[model samples]
Target: MSDAPIRVLVCDDQALVRTGYVTIFSAQPDMEVVGEAGNGHEAVSAAQRLHPDVVVMDIRMPLLDGIEATRKLAGPEVVEPPKVLVVTTFNVDAYVYDAFRAGASGFLLKDSPPAELVAGIRTVARGEALLAPTVTRHLIGRFAERLRPADTARPGRADLVRALTARELEVLELIAEGLSNAEIAAALFISPETVKTYVSRILTKLGLRDRVQAVVLAYRVGLVTAAD
Candidate 1:
């Protein structure tokens, strides 16, 4: 929101890819390319050193993978972690959920348009989790079968249900369903600001880093399902 350009660190194994990202990001007047990382190890080290507002990370890399690097930079134990925006190819869509679990704030397909990638970085920089509809659908389709079992009484369900009010639960369900704050407000007949308040409360109560974790928890607790 401030005039300060959003600081970004691009991390990938391929030189060409990193160069491409730098070019695109540098074109944005509101964004700054603070640094670059060739692998996950360098990503973590560089991120620690640069403290960029957002990290553009590739899921596959040498030494440490992007997932582990994301964890090191933004995991729950981290203090004041920078937001991570993971970029993946179709072959690695299966790792999408794992990246979110590892503390990624958002993800984009490797072939995503330059505009989309730029917007993703901005979204995460603003402390928003960017789970596009296609990405969410892919996540459910890829892992839903394994996530579901006949028994729905998973551990931590009771605590989660008890921790949130009915409205907060509804908001969480909408979040898991991939609705934006405006969409959730429309669906619930509440103002967008009100929806945001509910979201903040939900995150605080759940101790989640962001809405990505909220969605994962919703699936893990049987609150929202692939069928839904």
Candidate 2:
């Protein structure tokens, strides 16, 4: 990791929400809140100017909305993109799908513990995705349900599946089923620390940044079918 502190930009229409995030992040020695915005358009502009490492974006912001802001900042068009961690109030919000599709690196509920928020920002800043499997499955299920049948044919899926080892493949399936690390360890008869190691190795071997990317890869490769 780089020696620089992880710079963050908090984007939320609610002033209190922004202030709360600022307070929480400012207390971290390794994190710095570089800027703030109250809407999506401002968020895009701030990202371009400030070049923060991570953006804590609210999904329902006015002007452009967090999904569009995320796309503009981290979309495929950009040569170098800042990581976006979407903030939502609901666990199963439909906008979460749009946020992921728009290149968001992670999702955090508004009521998430302060530590989880800090960890999420750091994880995304470190080039990792921070999707919980349950949240991921919910997002994918919603996406697949709305997808047209003609778009189901994803290319390069076979190669991705062939890339996984037997153990890694097992872990991937369990992940799709929405098992937490502790639960996954118990299910696999392994230690939680071992599970974390396997998860990290899986991310590296698969060339996936985080669990969110892993879920997307799993869906794209048909390793975990939408129906499953």
Candidate 3:
């Protein structure tokens, strides 16, 4: 790991919110506000130029929405895309799902406290998905229908399933069900570090960006259900 502070690009349509984020991140020893964008278009442009480790993206913005910006910045098609943390509202639940699908590393409620927002940025920068149990459930509950049942014979299904050891498959299910690392650890009688290692191996084998993508793929592949 580099010794530099985690570089962050803050994107929000509102100036006030941007200011608040800037203030919070600037004060953190582990974080630095490398750039700021008031809208999605600017966000994409800045990301290209700045190459920040993480982007704090707002869902609704002029010129381009955060989802689109997220796609351009962190979509699967992009090579070495930066991590994106979406900040939005419950009312735009569909957009939140789209943001995740667009390759956001995590979602943060717009009204989340300053501490949470800071922690979320750090989490993503650490290459971890910042999905709490509640966030996971909310995501699955609200957007489960959007995920079509996986055709078992789809291009990567067999490969994905075969790539995991039985233990990894079990961990994947717990993850899809929205269990945090510690929770999954307790349930499986394993250490949190071990759970994290399983998660890392799972992501590597499946070519997933983070746990958010892991959860998405789990539901898509029928390893875990929306009902769970």
* Strongest candidate by lDDT: 1
| Per-residue C-alpha lDDT of model 2 across residues 190-217, encoded as one tens digit per residue | 9978888888888777655556556666
Task: For each of the candidates, give the backbone clash count.
Answer: 0, 1, 0
In model 3, how large is the Cα lDDT of residue 12?
94
lDDT, candidate 1, 122-154, per-residue tens:
888866678776667568545644543222235
The candidate, 1 or 2, that scores higher on lDDT is 1
N/CA/C clash count, model 2: 1
Could you tell me the TM-score of candidate 1?
0.85
- Where model 2 places Cα greater than 4 Å from the true spot, the runs are 90-92, 142-154, 174-210, 225-228
Best by TM-score: 3
Worst 10 residues of 1 by lDDT: 144-153
Q: Counting only residues 3 or more apart in sequence or on different chains, how many pairs clash (N, Cα, C under 3 Å) in candidate 1?
A: 0
Model 3 has a clash total of: 0
**In model 3, which runs have C-alpha deviations exceeding 4 angstroms?**
141-154
User: What are the root-mean-square deviations of the candidates from the true structure over C-alphas?
Assistant: 3.8, 4.0, 2.8
TM-scores of the candidates are 0.85, 0.76, 0.88
* Model 2 alpha-carbon miss at residue 137, Å: 2.6
Per-residue lDDT of candidate 3, residues 4-115 (tens digit)? 9999999999999999999999999989899999999999999999999999999889999898999899876787889999988764667767887788888889889989
